[model samples]
Every structure is written in structure tokens, then in C-alpha cells.
Target: MSQETAEPGIEASAKTAEIEALKDTFRNVPGLAGAPMIMAPALAETFATHQHELGVRVHPDLAVKKFIAPFRGPRDAFNPSGDYGAIDTPATPIPVLPNMREYTPHELEVIVGQLRDMGVVNDPEPPRDVAHVVTD
Candidate 1:
């Protein structure tokens, strides 16, 4: 005898449809260009968490180059002006942090704290090391 698999319930179907509709709405929204279409709340949280973590992991040199170099004025004492100073700055080659494994317990706690403040995570405890979560 052959058995048939159970179909999804009405609620499940409705939820899926709602998620799809939300995705479509997000796609048409302005100023959200190139943003990933994440349908699940858990997935979005994970993505945001990772993004913030990576932001914290950015090398100091690269951060300076990208965020500071553009607005930097000329190095002259008077009314010096130009991109010359920015261009003359030596590039520091630093190895990028690959993952959370490189972060210390304190670092993880700080990241978790920031995430909590931004409402990305609701954990009441602080994160300890890479694996441990801080408890009150």
C-alpha cells in the first residue's frame, strides 16, 4: 500500500502567503537597494547579528581609509586642500578577522550588549567568550 504525505495546514499556507507578500512589498520599497530579502524573523536576526559583528571586526586601517580618508582635508598647516594627504597615507595590510572565534569573551560581551541595545537580541544574559552567554 502507498501512503500519501500530509499537506500543510491552512494557517501555514496563510503564513507563507503573508511572508511572500511582505517580500514583494519590500522589493518595491525605495532606499532598500541591494538589501537581501529575508522572509524569516530568525534569519533576519542572524543576518543583522552577523553584519554587526563583521562591522566590529573591520580592521582599523581599512576603517580609517573608508570612513575617514574621504572627508580628510589637506595636511597643510594653513588652508591646505586636496586628496594628496589621503593618497600619500600608507596602506596597512592587516589580516581580517574571519569569525567570532577570534573574539575574546569581553569582546563578545560587548557585541552582545550592542545587539541587545539595538533589539537584535533579547537575551538578558551577556555573552561570555565565543560560546558562553553571560548570566545576571
Candidate 2:
């Protein structure tokens, strides 16, 4: 006996339409002129989680070169001064952090405290007292 497969529901069709609309939006962004229309399979889930938490989505197929310069010049890899120094050397690749959620609350607190001690404040306090302006 032959069996017929079920068609996609209304919800699925709506989601597909939304995704297509998003893809069209990404294609039209100024700086992202040539970014891919679809996210990579490996990054799909991670990016979806990011969108869920941050309410923003990044194009997965965006080229790294667009954001970072290629390393092929006489400038020092650690620090560059001018346009020639804009490129980053392979010796000092950008650092990627692991998921912070994996850390225990105590571990996160310790990390934040250490960073704060080292002069890294997430939210700096604003000046309280404002001097009154005198009109001549």
C-alpha cells in the first residue's frame, strides 16, 4: 500500500517566510554587502541561541576579512601605529571565549572580582555633584 506524506503546517510556513525575510534584510545591509544568505549548519544552533537571548542575529557566512585585516606587512603583530599596521599577524590570532554559562556562579563571581581589581568595570559610577554655572 502507498502512503501520502503530510504537508507543512501554517506555523512552519510562517517561520520559513520570516527566515526568508531576514535573509533579504541581511543582504541589503551596507557593510554586509556580500554576506551569505544563509547561516552555516555548524553555527545555526549557536546563532539561534544568541538571537533568542540578544534579540539580534549575525550573518553566519560573513567573511572574517571584512572585520579583520589580513596579515602581510612589516608592522609588528602586537601593536601597529598607522594604516600599514592595520593588519594582524597570524602569531596573534583573535581570542575566542568559551560559553560563560558553563561556569559556576562562584567561579563567575571570582572572575568578575579579579577583572574589577584589574580596573575592568562593567558599569562605572557617574559623578554625583554638578557645579552650578554662574552667569555674568
Candidate 3:
């Protein structure tokens, strides 16, 4: 039996449409102007990039407590391995690694271009210098 898969281009387009619709919905909400829309993949990458720093800030004695026994629960209640099992996780349409090094200029341009096309951003060119602040 042959397995059927979604065409990459079509899948991407559908995701883009979904994102645009969500943006439009958010745009109409009061008091939400200028808020940034962060997708899951971007959030995951951002978490990974600054994980060490985050751990230090959140738990100063994390290194010292690293050897502590982890909490155990029923296998059905807690999955230590983080396995999704049969759950189907959709792929991110736009893969973005948010960091000083991993996020490349090309990726920035592509994202900016997409935003411009969606009328979310008006600038013809992406900003040369962007500041990212991480706080505890």
C-alpha cells in the first residue's frame, strides 16, 4: 500500500493562509496593536538557544541540584521521554531559528518578504539592526 502525503507547496500555502487569517483576527482585537505573533517553532528555537541562560536565571542552583531524583508518576500520566505516540504534529511552514547566530540574514529576508506580501509590514527592506531582549 502506498502512503499519501501532502504536497509541500500546497501545505505551505495552506499554513500561510491560516497564519494570515489569524493575524487578521488579532488585528481586529482591541488593545492588541503592536503585539508580536510568535509561532510554536520560533518559540521552541528561542527556548533552545537561550536554555542555559534561562535555566541559570530561573534556577540558580540548578547545576547543584542536577543529581536530585526526578519525580515519578504513572506511565499513562507522565511521559518522561516526551513521546507523542500516535499524535500527528504538523510541520511548521516557516522554520525560524530566533537567535543572534542561528537566525540568518536570508531567513530574515524571507520572513520580511512574507510579512510585506501579507501587508503586515510596510517597510520595503528589513531593518539592518534589530534588538532582542531576554528577561527572566
**Which candidate number maximizes lDDT?**
2
lDDT of 3 at 59: 31
- CA-lDDT, candidates in order: 0.46, 0.47, 0.43
Ranking by lDDT: 2, 1, 3
lDDT string, candidate 1, 11-80, tens digits: 5775455454333322212225643332344553454445544542223344332211222443222221
Per-residue error (Å), model 3, residue 75: 54
Candidate 2 yields a Cα-based lDDT of 0.47
Model 2: per-residue Cα lDDT over 78-114, one tens digit each:
2222121222323444346689899999999999998
Q: Give the runs in model 3 whose Cα sits over 4 Å from its true position.
A: 1-3, 32-136
Extract clashing residue pairs from model 3.
none
Scored against the true structure, residue 36 in model 2 reaches a CA lDDT of 28
Q: In model 1, how large is the Cα lDDT of residue 49? A: 49
The TM-score that candidate 1 achieves is: 0.22
TM-score to true structure, per model: 0.22, 0.25, 0.22
Error of 3 at 129 (Å): 48
Where is the poorest 10-residue window by lDDT in model 1?
Answer: 75-84
On the 0 to 100 scale, the lDDT of residue 14 in model 1 is 54
